[model samples]
Target: MRADAARNVDAVLRTGARLLAEDPAAGMGAIAAEAGVDRRTVYRRFPSREALLAAVFQAKLDSAQRVLDEARLVEAPVAVALHRYVEGIVPVSRDWPVDVRRMMRADPAASVRREEQSGRLDRFVQRAADEGLLRADVPVAWARATLDHLVDTAAHGFPLIDPPQAADLVVDILLNGVGRR
Candidate 1:
């Protein structure tokens, strides 16, 4: 594709993602109009709404994966890595908000990428457990599940908080729980 064509495609995908996040039923005409592209252009690039949505979902996943990679979760101390990862991902999750279940079913490549990220996260949790950051009684799987839950909740619920503060809150809650103690 030419430079201008690529830019148009990017604009359409970005607009489609934002629109679909706000309304899953958003049409290609709306995406094209929002993207300042002709409806024919959108149709040429994406034959159907499902195709456009799949592209948007894949783009979102690719972006989130890039953020995770930049976080260097495997290189940092588990505590630090957890905070960095959460901070990096919060905005991606907030902006995309794709229907994860539908994405997994509709896009195999996305599902594979998600599994790869899950495996990386599992390794991080295992390292934390090994370093005694997590309770001895807690199984690694349980810890991994808990961490995933905490991050997802923070991503979905704490959009108003500053990214760094949201990361801090999530880590604090995960490590200390909510009880006054």
Candidate 2:
């Protein structure tokens, strides 16, 4: 694409990622304003609200994967690492990458992203079970789905006036649910 087109793409990604994460009800026009672009530009790149959200969602997922990579989740006990990773999802809420998880929920490619995370998280759970820290019958996919559900819930609909405390509630429940007895 042209230089300006690339810039527009990056801009929409940045804006969509933020407002959408902070509030799922955010609209494309707001994202365009944040990007310093017009509706025509936003539509040209994203085509529809769903399309824009997809790009935003993909960006977020890719970023989280990179964080997962850099944190070296493979370096620690799989259970400990995965729990901390999922918890990170709550406080880690900030910009586009965070929006990826949030937007993907409504975006068309959500199942694809879900499957991708599911596979990766499942591997981690399987490793945890292998290490005898998790129940042997615990399904890896279920663990992954649980984490996804928790992170998004904690991100958007935390109960307390304080978001952090609400996140804690989620993390504690997850840890307890999967904790070895």
Candidate 3:
């Protein structure tokens, strides 16, 4: 596609994502109006609401995967990688809060991507355990789940705090817990 066409597509997808997050019932017309594109343009790019939603969802996933890849989770020190991952994902979760549950159920490709990301995270948790960052007695799966919970919490709550502060808080809670030592 041409530069302007690509820009329009990006605008539409971004507008669609924001609108859907605010109201799942938001339609293409609203998204187009918000994006300053014609409704026909959106229709041309995505035949149905589901198609647009899927594209928006896919774009978020792709961005998240890129963040994880950039963090070098498998190669970096576990502590560093954990912080980096949380920091990287904050914007993705905050900006694209699409109804991921519904998308995962409705889109097969999304389901596969979710599993792929989960597998990577599980491996990263295992590595942390092997590095003695996580207690040996704790199951890797459990640790992974905890890490996911922490990241999600940070992502959801980031608007209340600075991104770096939120990332630090998440890492601190994950590594040190809430109890006074």
Candidate 4:
């Protein structure tokens, strides 16, 4: 695709994510208007709203995979990996705020991709425990869940804190509880 076309697609997908997130029933014309693209462009690229939504979800997954690849979860030190993952993912999470579970329900392919992502995170969390970054006694599921919640909190709850600082806060909270030490 040409540079301008790619830019238009990116704008459409991003605007679609934001508008659809705010209102799932948002129309293609509205999205195009918000994205500053022609409605024909949106319709040309995505025959239907569902297709556009699927594309948006795929964009989120692609971004997530990129973050995981960059974080080097398997090779990096657990603490370092955790911080990198959080820092990279917070913005991705915020940028593509679509719910993975909902996407999974709508598209089986998305479900598989999400499961793969979850599996990798699970392994990393388990590694963290094995490496003494997390308590061995804590169930891996619980730890992963807490980590997920923390990332979500960092992404959505702390609007003022930048991603890097949010990552630091998340890592600290995950490693050491909010309870008085």
Candidate 5:
């Protein structure tokens, strides 16, 4: 693809993520307008609203994969890896607000990617338990679920703060309870 076209596609996907996040029923024309791209350009690239949404989810997944790689989950200490992952993911969740779960039926490939990502997270959570960062008595699935919720809260509940800052708060909360110490 040409440089200009790639830029246009990026713009459209970003705008689509934002608008669709605000309102799932957002139209293609509205996304094109917000993206500052011609409607025909978006149409030519996506062909349909579902196609565009699938692409946005794919973009989010791609960003997530990069974050996972950068986090070095297998090599880094569990605490450090957790912070890195949350910091990287918070912005991704903010930028590409469309939930991949919503796109699963529309895009099987995206569903597969999501499952792979989830598997990695689950393994990381298990590693945390093995490393004594998390309690071995607790179910690994529960810890993983809690971590997922905490990240979502950090990303959406406190959108005003920078992701790295939010990541600190998230990691702290994950490691320590809110009750009095």
Candidate 6:
């Protein structure tokens, strides 16, 4: 694609995301109108509505990367790290489908980021285990998997109040195993 074509595509994708955040059912025509691009260009760039939406979502997730960075999931204690994880993920949780799917998809760039996230979470879990703060037998990989599920829920699961009521409880359940000592 030419430089102008790439710029036009990015513009359309940006417009589509802005519209979709307000209304997921926003139409292709509306997006094209917003971007001042023709319908042919929209279809030519994205091929399908889902593909376009996916691109919009990836952009949103990219914008959200700093939350994970601030959480310091790999730098802090397991329990505190888990709490920060909830705080980090809740904002982006509003648009769960796009965020969760794009993160989990096997795209090389996304995967590298995901692995970095996993490694950070792992380091925290390792520290917690060493401190006897978590179940010593809990595998770092399992902790990472549980976090992924929790974050995905924060994203894609049923909605509730703003900031989400169940996040702390769910994180607690994951860390504590929900059984009597």
For TM-score, the strongest prediction is: 4
Ranked by lDDT, the better of candidates 4 and 5 is 4
Task: Assess the local accuracy of residue 173 in candidate 6 as a C-alpha lDDT between 0 and 100.
Answer: 76
lDDT tens per residue, model 3, 1-181: 9999999999999889989989999989999999999999999999999999999989999988988898799888888888888888888887788877877888999989987987898888888888888777778888777877777787775577766777798888877778998
Q: Candidates' TM-scores?
A: 0.85, 0.59, 0.91, 0.97, 0.95, 0.61
* Runs of candidate 4 exceeding 4 Å displacement: none
Candidate 4 backbone clash number:
0
lDDT of 5 at 21: 83
Global CA lDDT computed for model 4: 0.92
Q: Alpha carbon lDDT of residue 172, candidate 1?
A: 86
Q: Which candidate model has the greater lDDT, 3 or 4?
A: 4
Off by over 4 Å in 1: 1-7
Candidates ranked by TM-score, best first? 4, 5, 3, 1, 6, 2
**lDDT (10s digit) by residue, model 1, range 122-170:** 8888888888888888799987787777777877766678789888987
Q: Which residue pairs in candidate 6 collide?
A: none
Q: Judging by TM-score, tell me the better candidate of 1 and 2.
A: 1
- Of 5 and 6, which scores higher on TM-score? 5
Worst 10 residues of 5 by lDDT: 172-181
Give the root-mean-square deviation of each candidate in angstroms: 2.3, 5.4, 1.7, 1.0, 1.2, 5.9
TM-score of candidate 3 versus the correct structure, residues matched by position:
0.91
What is the alpha-carbon lDDT of model 5 when measured against the actual structure? 0.91
- The better candidate by lDDT, 1 or 3, is 3
What Cα-based lDDT does every candidate model obtain?
0.83, 0.66, 0.86, 0.92, 0.91, 0.68
To one decimal, what is the Cα RMSD in angstroms of model 3 from the true structure?
A: 1.7
Q: If both were scored by lDDT, which would come out higher, candidate 1 or candidate 5?
A: 5
Error of 3 at 47 (Å): 1.3
lDDT of 4 by residue, 118-157 (tens): 9999899988888888777789899999999999988988
Q: Tens digits of per-residue lDDT for model 5 on 1-181?
A: 9999999999999999999988999999999999999999999999999989988988999999999999999999888999999999999999898876787777899999999998999999888888788766789898888888988888889889998898898888777756797
Could you tell me the TM-score of candidate 5? 0.95
